[model samples]
Target: MSTIDNTFEAQSSAGVSGPATRGSIIARLERLPANAMLVRARILIGLATFFDGFDVIAIAATLPILIGKWHLTPWDVALLIGASSVGQLIGAFLFPWYAERHGRVKAIALSSGVIGVTSIACGFAPSFAVFFALRIVQGIGLGGELPVAATYINEICRAHGRGRFVLLYEIVFPVGLLASNALGAWIVPRFGWEAMYFIGGVPLILFFVLRKLVPESPRWLAERGRMSEAADAVHAFERTAKTALPPMGDPASFESMVARHPKRKMSDLFGKAYWKRSAAVAMLWMTCGVIQYGLSTWLPTIYRTVYHAPLQLALNLAVAASVLGVLGSLLCAMLVDKVGRKPIINWSFMLCALSLALAGVFHDASVYVVAMCCAFALGWLACGFITAYVYTPELYPTSIRAFGCGVGGAWLKLAAIFAPTLVSKTMIGGNLDVAFYLLAVVPFLAALVVQFLGIETKGKVLEQLEA
Candidate 1:
């Protein structure tokens, strides 16, 4: 197989299934083009993730109003904001467990349903405590969706432009984030804070659409020995490929195996074979977590607190910065496969550190706010953010794909948990520059780690990473 052809095909090695069902499903998914079935899967999965972007920003967007509405202290506000991150930690792990056992479809439906209902209930929260509790429930769903969706999206795509398609689906996250900021800036003044939660509730409707339109990962089923259902899922794509592509000038053939694949436990992530990849992915997640959650949760608040920008103006700047993030993601999607994964990640983390650090150095500059926006845009917002989302799931195979991704996500939520406290203590106490300077060092260190330890996933078969 060509490098691009290898991108989608599973490895030629035995797995938990030993020789049984080794690579049949992946061999099938690998030959497909940008057909209707792939397009439909992207849209369905992307929609679920798109709302996750909004859900993550729900607290960040409305905290200004919430602070006043409930007479909140900084600690109270921090607790309220971080509550969801905490919930996300649990949900991230929880649903992946469910996904590995039952199916990705069931896991997502359960998670999305949680998000929709809790979001609506959040609109009616009469007190900060009640709202905080509801957000934890909402967080569970929000947390579960992205990694699983990334795995789902990644599973369906061949490595040809895998980064681009997955990131495009993933880009909805920042767009959803940018949308939240834009809408909050527009709606909060007129419609009041409750409107943010109410508007957020709207994406819950997409959950039903997702369940109807999307199917379980065929490879997941095949790995579990459910050959009949797996064949059914794989057939949908086969039909699409037949319609979409001309007959192969040369026919390709695959070998089939007969045997029972062993069930994969979450612990397999730490087994000798997978331990290194898991560690690398976890480190990437931890570094990206600090940058991702820390920045997303605190950027607007930094503007409002240190610069004294009005709530609306601060959020507007956040939306504008996120538009830059959107543009950055578009750029990364174009170049990721061509340039490869490790290089994009290395450059992204380092540049993000430098830019964000510069934004801090001149914190009191007349252009300080724009400086921050620029730093966030070029550094992590676009390429780095896209890199982590697309790359982490690629490092693992179908057996523990969600759990591996979920572990990385848990680190992000961990960062989310501490990011607020770190900011509240410093930015609110008149030492904003110190806080940012500290944050700047993290990604730079992350860049160095990637340069040394990161594997070049480019031009390799997705399953070959483990092989």
Candidate 2:
């Protein structure tokens, strides 16, 4: 009899029978050679991630134009920028629970639909109250998509080169950010701020495409004891392999490893085995959130209002910073598996702090100097930001992986909800330096926390990591 047949017999005799045992499912997946299905899955999921990125900065790009057209006050600008984040915060808490109960793909599709429909409504909003309400509703979709998507992508990939594979897919997000800025710079000026929201709504089509093309995470299925579905999902990927597959590992051993760990509950996130990890990731994500949204949402407006730069020049500079962000994310993707997650996160946060401090110190200098420093700060933070997606899911077991990611993302949304207002208040006298200085502190503290508390998850399988 074949090894897989023996695995099934063993599982059946052990009173754990299913169409396929979880051990066989995992062993087959781990041995799957890269193929068209994996690429296709990545691309389809990357599109959802891309739109999340695009919509995130869509407000940043359009804010400068809206500020003038609506004659918005600084508080109004803060509220508008924060509206989606508020919705995202709510989505962050809600969807992960949905994903944990229903499935990742379903949660993602529903959220994408929410974002697409509301984003279209945002374009047609007739008043500030209407737009603000639309943005918050759109934010719910935006908030739900990313963490679930990250969890899905992480579950599908094998441990070997997983970091590079997932991070490469994640690069699309930064590219989306870049695209929104580049397009907004061109489109909003020619068409109107409404065009940005119209364009943002185009991802509605992706909702259907996702349902058709992408399969659910087999790891998630196996964890949920849906072995029949898990087996089918594994075979779908195996069919795409061009080369001979590697020998499957011992399924009995894999099963034993999994059985050794007690089933994790959501409350365990703050329990002994996980609380440190939860704390570290929370701080990491929130700090990244405060810095990322604080800058991306405000840079263009600061350029326009404080520096008196032309609207195009301000948007163009934001575009330049996004380009640097993409480069930094790419660089991290290439190196994450090699150097490992902890060191990369630590160094990136520290360097980001240095850059932000420099920007704050030189805030009194020429606009170009401050811009350059802030751009570099964002570049460094992008490295840590992208790494968080890779690292957060790794820290949790399969049963709670999506939920863990959601909670970490919740911290991000929580920070994002308050960051714009904090930035606005600090820049009261056009003192951009104060915001930068304050932003620098959180990341530095986070780096220290990571150094002491963060778990290293390089080149390790998800199940094994949980063990």
Candidate 3:
């Protein structure tokens, strides 16, 4: 039998704990079902993610006004839209590495605090240059919080129900994006674009609740060999035990997770043990970025340029499309646990590619707009975008979970940085089909990658995945 099969022990807890083996934090957490503590943690994390989602699409939400007032050329449009994403690399690479060494809680707190300050500053920028710099700062905060937060949420969830649990909390991100689009539709046109920034800045105050509300991931603590700290964190995450814990070993003998899964060098993320998983996730991230980001940031611009949509109508259409995006994301959150990650991701990406391709072939403006709406729904709800977020962190052990997630996120941001640039160049005049056709190929490929390479993580323990 494989180490994975031997270590995981058939996923049955026997519905009771002997208190001795219960001493292991992983055994303790896995035994319990979801309860109040997890609920509160999700709410707290969801609130931060909601704003992160809001700020992520905030530029796109207000793109019409930026293009008009600033006289932004297509190239300038790409820079303005992609600037925050440029800074995401730093947040994605740096903070999660820090979290691996320091802790998940502190990393999240500091990152959230940075987002708050930068968002408020963005509201008052004097020029496009100042605004661009402010966005980079905000992206830093945005990038830092997500991967670490994902690690904490995933670790605390019960293995049987982990996908639904984590993805449900993740659903807030799209809702935030939808809300930003709706808010910008109403506020940016009448009240001006700064209103969007001001609203985003105000949410920074919620970051305070994170430290007091959510506990560190016990799995992470255990991986670090801080067993006592892991125990305390498990207690903090679960106020009461739901069932019997695993059996402890004889007093003189100890089973060692550290020995079984030896410490991987930082460089090993690209080596034999993890490279396939990493490549699969990275490719998924990039394709989702191209498919989703390419369309998301440019939808309103596409609406105006192609159909000659008026400002209010353009924003209104963008808001309506986001409604589909939100519903699709919620659908993904609901089905991920039931349907399993690989099948859902495979089919979703296939549908996303089909939608984009259909839209590309039909040159009619009405067909194009409706096609985009279909693509948004299929991609956000089922395609590998939401699937990737829930699946990527599960692939690595806690030692590099955050780093793995961070790199996955960084690739998406890097794609976001380029997607808009690519779309901007082609979206002018009647070349819009070029952008759609370009974006379609990757999602189709992503579906195949998931089929062959994506691991089924729906009900598996985090540690068992690497085993």
- CA lDDT of every candidate: 0.73, 0.87, 0.75
Summarize candidate 1's per-residue lDDT along 1-467 as a digit string, tens digits.
55323322322211112222435566656666657777788776777777788878867788887877889887887787789989999988998878878888778777877888898899899998899899888999988988888877777776567788888888888888778878888888898888888877865776677667776888788778775566557656656653543232111232222122334467887886667667666667776666666666666676777677877777877777777778778888888889988888778777777777777777778545544644463446468767788888877767888888888888778877887787678756887777778777877887777677567787554665552
For this target, which candidate reaches the highest lDDT against the unseen true structure?
2
Model 1 TM-score (2 dp): 0.89
Error in Å for residue 455 of model 3: 2.0
Off by over 4 Å in 3: 1-23, 240-259, 367-382
**Candidate number with greatest TM-score:** 2
Per-residue CA lDDT of candidate 3, range 146-245, in tens? 8878877877876787888888888887788889989998888788888898888755676676777777777777777665456566665445445444
- Extract clashing residue pairs from model 3: 16-244, 17-244, 17-245, 20-248, 21-246, 21-247, 21-248, 328-381
lDDT (Cα, tens digit) per residue for candidate 2, span 70-187? 8999999999988988999988878888999888988888888988899899899898999999989999899989999999999888889999998999999899999999999999
How would the candidate models be sorted by TM-score, starting from the highest? 2, 3, 1
Clashing pairs in 2: none
* Whole-model lDDT, model 2: 0.87
lDDT score, residue 84, model 2? 89
